[model samples]
Every structure is written in structure tokens, then in C-alpha cells.
Target: MKYSKATDYALHTMLFLVAATPNKPIGVQQLADRQNVSPTYLSKILTKLVKAGMVESASGANGGYRLKRNWENISFLDIIHAVEGTASLFDCSFDHGSECPIQQVVLSAEAKMEEHLRNQTMFDLAKKNKNKIVW
Candidate 1:
């Protein structure tokens, strides 16, 4: 499945935060510049994360966002759900009335796909990155 840009930013921001030294609140501009994304776009991304209670925000001179929980506690599904809402890979309503046989197959396939995505977590993703990537 294709992940959205919002999910990409959220993942990058979380990984950057996870890699940061203790007690350092990363500024949005810094995250934007480092990730090479627009600051405005990152701000909007963070806003959704904040609303979902995945990340916390601070205000004033020494203000920025930090995770509400540890990296291990934050799941990819959690982030994806926050950014994109639930993965409704199937909607087999068939005009809101009839049940088509083709739709039944589609729904079953979608359910399996959804299960795979839901079972995935950021920690699992991090582990994969840990060996293959460096920065």
C-alpha cells in the first residue's frame, strides 16, 4: 500500500525525535529543513498528530513538539490512523443495497491487507531501518 506524504512526515519527525538526545525539543523549522519539506506542511502534519494525542506541543520561546509516549509505544498503525484515518480498503455496499459476488472477493482481500497493515508497528519499521540506513 502507498503511504501518504503526511504519514511520511510524521514518521520522519518521530524518528528524528527518537534519535534526539534527552530533553531536546526539536523545532519545526529544523525538522522541515532536515527533512527537506516545507515548514508549513510539517506544521499541519504535527497539528493532526497533536490532535490524535500521539505528540505533545509546547508554546513560547522554548517551544516545540515531543512525543506523548516513547518510540516503542508509538505504532505505525497509530500514526497512519491519525494521519489518514482508518484503512477502509473495502466498502462493499454495492449501491448501499445489493451484495455482489465480486464485492465479496474484494472485501475479503481488503480485510487481509488491512490486517497486515494494522499488525505493523513503527518499532518494526525502525528495526528494519536500523540495519539498512544511517544518518
Candidate 2:
């Protein structure tokens, strides 16, 4: 299943922030530039994360975005749900409330995916990718 571009940006933003110095906020422009995304678009994504309680923002000269929780506590699933909601690959609902035959199968797959994502966290990923990625 494919997620929206917003979701991709949100994940990237989270990963970037996970690497930042604690209590030190990163400016939107700086983050946008580093991520190679539009500042306006990134700001909207950051707002969504902030509202989801995954990230926090500050105001004034030192104003910027930071994670609300530690990277170890922030699961990849959390970021996905924060940006995309609990959207399934296939909609199980039908008109008149009719039960779809494939609903169970789809739901099972979704559950598996959720379980896998929930088991993984930003800190875990950072450790795994530390040597491979630049940051």
C-alpha cells in the first residue's frame, strides 16, 4: 500500500528531528532545506504531527519543531497514523452495511502490518541505519 507524499515527508521530518539535539528546535526553513521539501508543505505536515502529539513546536526566535516523545517511544506506526490516520489498504465497509467476503482477509493483513510497524521505533531505525545513512 502506498501512502501520501505528506506521509513520506512526515516520516522524513520525524527521522530528522530524532537526530537533533534535545531541547534544541530546528527551524522550518532549515528542515525544509535539509529535506529538500517545500517549507509551506513541511509546515502543514509539522502541524499535523504537533496536533497528533508526536511533535511539539515553539514560538519566537528559538521557535521550531521537536519531538514530543523520545525517539525510542515513537513508533513508525505512530508517525504513519499521525499523518495518514488508521487507513486500511482496502475499505471494508459496504453500502447497506453488507459484509464483504474479503474484509477479514484485508483486516488480517492490516493487523499484521500494524503489528510490525508498532514493533519498530525511531531509535531502533536510527541505530540500524546509523552507519549506512549520513544522518
Candidate 3:
């Protein structure tokens, strides 16, 4: 149910990239400033995104981060997994193996949530909030 702050930053950073300028690279400082977070910390998150092929980093004065060519097809679940990993949210403490009823329920819920997230992309979100958000 609960996710990391890194995931939160990553999601917002991705949204900003998609909404503000998908092709244009934005510096880590600017991205951090928007969320009031540390540029160094945000950089670490960006690194993960880069490794995941969700975004790419450029060098030099106008260098920064920008979405990849397939960013429009990137689902929320993709971003979430990129930062959070593909580990299950809940793991039953008891040694009930794969037959654990409690684990089954939780896993089912997680699957549904992931399915919903998989249906929602940053491009869709940006388009929906285009008028509402400044970017």
C-alpha cells in the first residue's frame, strides 16, 4: 500500500517531463526545486529512470534529463516498478507457502491495483491535467 518517497519524486518528475517538455531536457536542480527536494537525491532517482530506459540524460550546459522515445507508452506501473522494484507489497510471515489464503487475497488486490496502474500513462495524465496544471 505504502510506497517510498523516491517513488513519489520519480512519479512527479516523470509527470513534469511529460507535461512540461517531453523532448526538452530539464536539469536536476529545476526538477528538485519543483518538489522542494535535494538535487542530489533526485539525481539518484533519475539515474534509476535512465537505467530503466524511461528517461535519458544529456551532458553539457543544456544537458539534463528527458523522456525516452517510448515515453508515451510508459505506464504508471512501469515507473513504479522502475523505482520500487517488482517485489510484492505483502509477504505472509507464516510459512503457508503459495497456498496461503491471506497472501492470495493481498496478491489479488495488488494485481488489480497494478492492472489499473498499467492502464494509466504519464501522457494520459498530462493531457487530462493540461488545463488544470500550470505546466
Candidate 4:
């Protein structure tokens, strides 16, 4: 499955926050500038993270955002679920209303793939140690 720019930015922004001090809130503008993303777009992503309780926001000069959980605790799947939603790859897994058996098999396999990604945390994706992202 391909990740949208929103997901990519979310990951980059989250990692930036993760590397920051617990008490320090990095400004949205700063994040955007550093990641070369639009601040407006980044704000939308930040809103999702805030709503998901992945990050906390405050207003003013010292206001920005801080991770609600440690880097290790926050997973890539969590970010995707927070923004895109917890949409399973399979349209219907538990309940099969279609009459086609082939559809059922496809759905089962799709479900398994989704489950695999869900189980693989963000920590797994960000396995490299302080290396320049070659993307």
C-alpha cells in the first residue's frame, strides 16, 4: 500500500517531535520549514494527531506541540489510523454477504495484510539510527 503525503509528513513531523524535549513544543512553522512542507497542510495533520491524543497543543509564544506518548509508544499504524482511519484492507472480514467464494478468499488475504501492517509499529519503520533520510 502506498502512503500519501499526509502520512509521510505526519511521520516526519512526529519524529521531529519525538527527538525534542518533552517540555519543548516545536512550532508548526518550524516543522513545515524543516520538512519543506506547507505549514497549512502540516497544521491539518497536527490537528489529527492532537485529536488522536498523540500530541498536545498550546497557544502563544512558547506554544507548539509535544508528543503525548514516548516515541517508542507511538506507532506508524497509530498515525495512519488517527488520520486516515482504521479502515481494514478487506471490505468485509467477519461478515460475508457476497455469494462469491473467490471474493471471500481475497478478503481474507487482504485482512491478513492489513493486520500485518497494523501489528508492525512505527518503531519498526523508523529502525535506522540517526541517519540522514535518503529519501
Which candidate's lDDT is highest?
3
**Local accuracy of candidate 3 as per-residue lDDT tens digits, 29-62:** 9999999999999999999999999999999999
| Candidate 4 C-alpha lDDT tens digits along 1-135 | 566889889887877676555458888998889888889999999999999988999889999988776656787678877778876544644455776686778778877776775676555445554464333
Candidate 1 weakest lDDT stretch, 10 residues: 89-98
Q: Which scores higher on TM-score, 1 or 2? A: 2
TM-score (C-alpha) between model 4 and the true structure: 0.75
lDDT of each: 0.75, 0.82, 0.93, 0.76
Model 1 Cα lDDT, one tens digit per residue, 1-135: 577988988877877676563246678898888888999999999999889987778887878887676646676667878888885656654575336777777778767776786777666666667665344
Listed in order, each prediction's TM-score against the native is 0.76, 0.88, 0.96, 0.75
What ranges in model 2 sit over 4 Å off?
93-99
Candidate 1 error regions (>4 Å): 21-23, 90-93, 96-98, 131-135
The residue-by-residue lDDT of candidate 2 on 1-135, one tens digit each, is 799999888887887787666457899999899878899999999998998888789988999987775656888899999889885778755652335658877777889999999998887777788766453
Stretches of model 3 off by over 4 angstroms after superposition? none
Give the worst 10-residue stretch by lDDT in candidate 4.
126-135
**17: Cα error in model 1, Å:** 2.4
Q: Rank order by lDDT, top first? A: 3, 2, 4, 1
What TM-score should be assigned to candidate 3?
Answer: 0.96
The deviation in Å at residue 110 for candidate 3 is 0.6
